[model samples]
Target: MGIVSNRQNASDYDDDMKRAKAAGIDAFALNIGTDAYTDTQLAYAYQSAADNDMKVFISFDFNWWSASQGSEVGAKVAKYANLPAQLMVDGKVFVSSFTGDGVDISAIRSAAGCNVFFAPNFHPGQGDFGDVEAALNWVAWSNDGNNKAPTLAKQLSVSSGDNTYKAALDGKPYIAPVSPWFSTHFGSEVSYSKNWVFPSDLLWYNRWREILQESPRFVEIITWNDYGESHYVGPLSSPHTDDGASKWVMDMPHNGWLDMAKPFIAAYKAGSKFPIEFLDEEKLVYWYRPTPKDVDCDATDTTMQGNPNNSSGNFFRGRPDGADTMADEVFLVTMLKEPATVEVQSGDISVTLEASPGVWSHSVPMGVGAQSFKVTRGGKTVDSLSGTSLRDITDTCPCGIYNFNAYVGTLPAEAAIDQLQPDGLTMLSQGLQVACPTNTLGASSASAT
Candidate 1:
């Protein structure tokens, strides 16, 4: 499901539908607030989806809707209930809400002629909507790095609980969620930043595998365009751009995550192992936190206060998990069609692994030097990628704020080896460098065109 902006116009909807369809998605779950301006925008989106031969649904934001507006909400919903682009399931129009506990689902459905297929994410266990047709839980955070085994175990626990929730429906559907990463510092208005992360190192791969195993009727990628959350897998262009958030994200591209998701999407739908193909050339895509755990690179910048609404786990709970203290390491996913030795060079701590056909990932300790990678087979280099030069330690945040955005960079497939030149050095005597100096202010603040 695509998380779309209600500010989008007809043309923007057309373009986003085209992109989402190309990526094997079927619908855009328009995340809407209770505003007349948004109501008009939703109309344009519905018409655009109908024009593009796609489906659209509404995800009412409870944060924006009051409990007393039930009938009004229903009337507003019924306006688009019969639209051609409105997603229908088993003769009912599909509708879901974000934390819709206060808003009475049954009352809204009754007002809408009781013909809605309701499946709202009501946070968990606040109250049960036993009459709703389906169940949805958007709890897709594991917040761990590439330690695959433990990550899978944690996800399985979620899936296990979801399975029980599904069983309560007695054969109705469950919308499972999957995400690539989460870091909302640069774009949040809340008191504290959402610095938690689920490693993108094979994240798309692992999440899809787990989702397929759980066999949910529907799967929603956590976001297609919530750029502030830093989990967006769609383009960094306009209409689908920032919702009054940071400009830092406009330059930090996660489009590579979409490129990495194609195979997984196909496999999940077909219920078979879809051989991952190279959408682009064989490359190593990577990202990492610029500042590590509890490391203050900028003393002048006041660090954010704790989020009172933050979930109780790992980094959000003010307690570090086992992997929480793990240094900020470069996470790389290598796609190769043949066996090759992929080397991660950070300072003198160079580690090489024999990567066979398909995608495999590795993490190397980041240090006070440039980071780079090379793929070689039979003593000949096949392809190589040069990363951005690491920044120096500083005593101030570039934007004078606690910046939590990941510094994402890529060594393009066609990049010259000389482009990745790093200072020759030996093993890092310490672990991964926890914090790197922030880049110049506004360096990552380019607005989308």
Candidate 2:
């Protein structure tokens, strides 16, 4: 998971670690820039990880550092190499990066004065770094063959990037990335200019299945709290939204996505195929953009062209490349203990599908108004989400700004009965009743539909 450096205290890191641990996450890759609070935040994060029995490693943001700063990067890594929470591999420090392809890895290891397992993202041809022990492929989304300048008109093969990276690794470890969605609305207002959306209908469900099939050495979810890009799978922590991203992220909650990922994560670690066996509770997780794609806004941010820093901007204006590629539909995934009938209602459009016992994904065209969902087994309503529970899809842009961000919701919305404790952590109320009946389904019988 990618953790931004905007935390206030150790407690903030503790809360995130606890939640991540509960989700079966092992470590957090702290993405830090050259901000003044980098050291302070890293200290808090390392301490919290140690307290929570979680591992952590630093991932330098090359946007702030240049190829000449290899020594500075190595010094930072060495400073925390001996920390209790630092992630170590084979008695060597585990180091990674977002983008620092041309940097000298030998200089980094020489400065650190220790063995280093380097796994930096060297996209657009994994550079000639013979010292790289492993490689990290950061292209998590489906796109054209071009990684630097993707053609919006071409549809690339699914998991094509992973295949290429595996071939390039030549039997070495390849860290594959998996992300549910991607859409940013930043412009020249911020130091960078980025605005675009990949075609991500059912991406969250599809990518997990792909991971189970490929079983890469390591799988890093693209982000945990990248609100500006709208792919955050963590809870909405207001304190971490200081990057002017709250405008679109405040009311949007993506905890349901994590809940849906629990079973898949467990199965992946267990070396199992497409998981169908851990359906202890029935869950119906759904996600969709609040506004229709056809809606017009006063400003349209330009689509990103490879590097955000080098791209020109028009303040808050320009149309995204794949805007027209997005389907006007509500994507959903269901985890059931038995065969059931699922129904999705988006405004006046309702679509029903019969799902067998296991995990299933389906989508229905979106409509204007409140959305609702339900699961029925043997002609009885087992689980459901009323229309009043979620925000209604509208024709106008939210707050007059284009928000391609997705709002995810579950059948038994956990937020409805979540209680904030004295320690500033939210927990589900104990012994809460759920609409879906529980069952003891064996993992061997679990299958994906």
Model 2 steric clash pairs:
276-446, 276-447, 277-443, 300-317, 300-318, 301-317, 301-318
Model 1 lDDT, residue 35, Cα: 57
> Candidate 2: lDDT of 159?
89
The global Cα lDDT (0 to 1) of model 1 is 0.59
Tens-place lDDT per residue, model 1, 1-449, is 12243344687577778878877888888887865577678888899899998999988877787777778778877988989999998898898877777677667877887488888775445636577777677766543223221354454334554665676666777888888766544212333333444434445557766876776888888887676667777655535322333433523456666656666677677776543553344666666654444554343232233234344222232211232423467677766667778787765568887777776666777654556677678898764543443332222343334444455444563121111001111111111113222213234442212
Local distance difference test values of all predictions, in order: 0.59, 0.72
lDDT of 2 by residue, 115-171 (tens): 888888876464644668788887888776553224646767558888887877788
Which residue runs of candidate 1 sit more than 4 Å off their true CA positions? 1-8, 143-157, 160-164, 167-170, 186-203, 240-244, 247-250, 274-283, 302-327, 384-401, 409-449
Off by over 4 Å in 2: 1-6, 124-126, 145-153, 299-318, 383-388, 416-449
Residue clash pairs of candidate 1: 348-426
TM-score of every model?
0.75, 0.86
Question: Highest lDDT: which candidate?
Answer: 2
